[model samples]
Target: MTSLFQFTGSELEAIKLSVGVAIYSSLISLPIALLLGYWLARKQFPGKAIIESLIHLPLVMPPVTTGYILLLVLGTRGFIGQWLYSTFGIKLAFTFEAAIIASVVVSFPLIVRSIRTAIEMVDPGLEDASRILGVGRLKTFFQITVPLAAPGIISGTILAFARSLGEFGATITFAGNIAGETQTLPLAVFAYMQVPGREIETLRLVVISVLISFVAMALSELYIRKMKRS
Candidate 1:
């Protein structure tokens, strides 16, 4: 039983790849999410509705469909992909990079929505006051709006990270779950479940996934509470 419980080299590699993909995806998504969220919260433009709809599209779209779209747009034979590969030797499909992109796409909406809500929570009067005090708009935003929204940003970032950690459908569809490459824990769990004698391994991975999610949520809650107190 102990021997069976032991993770093989491939399993270890899968775990590492999973963490790498999730971390990369979350970090890359954070700044973009912040900027878009701020824009959505603070600005009202003619095509704002269209942009907001696009940002929220992933929340409603099927993960598999999103993955397929990514493949179509970023595959080796894709127009953009062909240019990337030819000009810069970059290709995205069926690779860890693809997995990161899939994770980012799926997780982005949560971060954006969270931060947008936070931004809206900030009082516009504060900005008015700052402007009257001769503070530039950008300075007011960096000092007042952003700090006030810190808790929301933190919660949103954690949510995105957690979403990335658990992403499966988009990742597998776009990256093909190749071991030691694109296979994250969710993909590994699926693969293990399909094997003849890996139920325990699958269960273990499931437990780990649950634990990771639980921790992320707990941290978010803690931050939220602290923010409220502050």
Candidate 2:
């Protein structure tokens, strides 16, 4: 019974790395997503369409292409990468950090879109009333706007986490799929698939992946329903 569910060392490593990367990716991207979502929803500025198009480019672009671009810009010897390594001796390429970055890039658009829609649905009258009552913009945003849009933010965060857990092409490309380091669950599944007699392991990972995604979706749906009810 316990043996049936026991994970091998490599499988355990993959699961841990996947969860770690996904969590960090989601947490790191949340603030940026919130800012972008609010700006896109409530503010008007020049080149807004251009900014939106760029933000969503990852959704349309090949995952490998995005990975390649990251490698060029953030690789060990690349521009910012070189500077960081020289100044602080920090290397990003082929590391867990790179995997987190990849997940953030690919999942960012979805997070931003969800949050933007949620913010847009917030009542302008509430914000106006807050302002009329001498509440500052920042206070109103944190107090009223954020509370009202919490459902959407939570949904987007879960979706991003699910997406990060399933990330493959970008992670493999930028982070090199190193076992016990950058190799996440999706990469582990791909590795198992390439070898003979590893079908069981591959299938196990597939099941795990599907379950995680299903749970995330279910939670998102529940949030949407709750939002509707409120």
Candidate 3:
């Protein structure tokens, strides 16, 4: 089992990259998800249904399909991708950024859903009282709404981080599993599975991924419980 304790360079890199991507993806998606969730919870605008459906499409679609759509939009030769490349020399596909983007797309709907539910559950009268006291909407949001929705926000962020850590199909499809760059735990596990005598490495990565996901979920649940009790 000493061999199992010994981590290969690739394994360590994969762990680090996976964590970095998960963190970046969670941080990047939070503000947008917060605003979008508040909108979905509070607004009754025309075409909102269509917008929400589009936002949630990734959740229902096969991850590969989502990745393919991102590819079409962001690839070097793709539709708008060509314009981006011609204008800015920016090619997003098969890159570290692409992996984070993939994780964000796939995990966004879940975060939004959680936040929206939390916002909806909050009493509107509280917001109205804040408004009557001359608090601006933005201030009220940060001071009142956000504190009340802290449980959901924290849970949603944890869920996003966990989902990003375990992301595979979209990441692989868009980022191509390049080691020490776009490769994460799931990708590393996949790679190790393909190599002979790599069983230990694969097992270790799998255990790590599962443990991380479980801990994230547990933390979310515990925090929710504690908040409710208080």
Model 2 segments beyond 4 Å from truth?
A: 1-4
The true-versus-predicted C-alpha distance at residue 125 of model 3, in Å, is: 0.7
User: If the candidates were sorted by their TM-score against the true structure, best first, what order would they fall in?
Assistant: 3, 2, 1
Candidate with more favorable, higher lDDT: 1 or 2: 2
**What is the TM-score of candidate 3?**
0.96
* Per-residue lDDT over 1-230 for candidate 2, one digit per residue giving the tens place of the 0 to 100 score: 34446679999899889989989999998999998899999999999999999999999999999999999999987899999999999999999899999999999998999999999999989999999999999999999999999998999999899999999888998999899999999999999999999877887778878887898789789877887798
Candidate 2: residue 7 Cα off by (Å): 1.6
- Candidate 3 error regions (>4 Å): none
Best of the candidates, TM-score: 3
Candidate 2 vs candidate 3: the TM-score winner is: 3
For all candidates in order, the CA lDDT equals: 0.89, 0.92, 0.92
* Tens-place lDDT digits, model 1, residues 128-212: 9999999998999899999999999999899898889989889988899898899999999999888898788887777778877
Q: All candidates: CA RMSD in angstroms?
A: 1.5, 1.5, 1.1
Poorest 10 consecutive residues by lDDT, candidate 1:
1-10
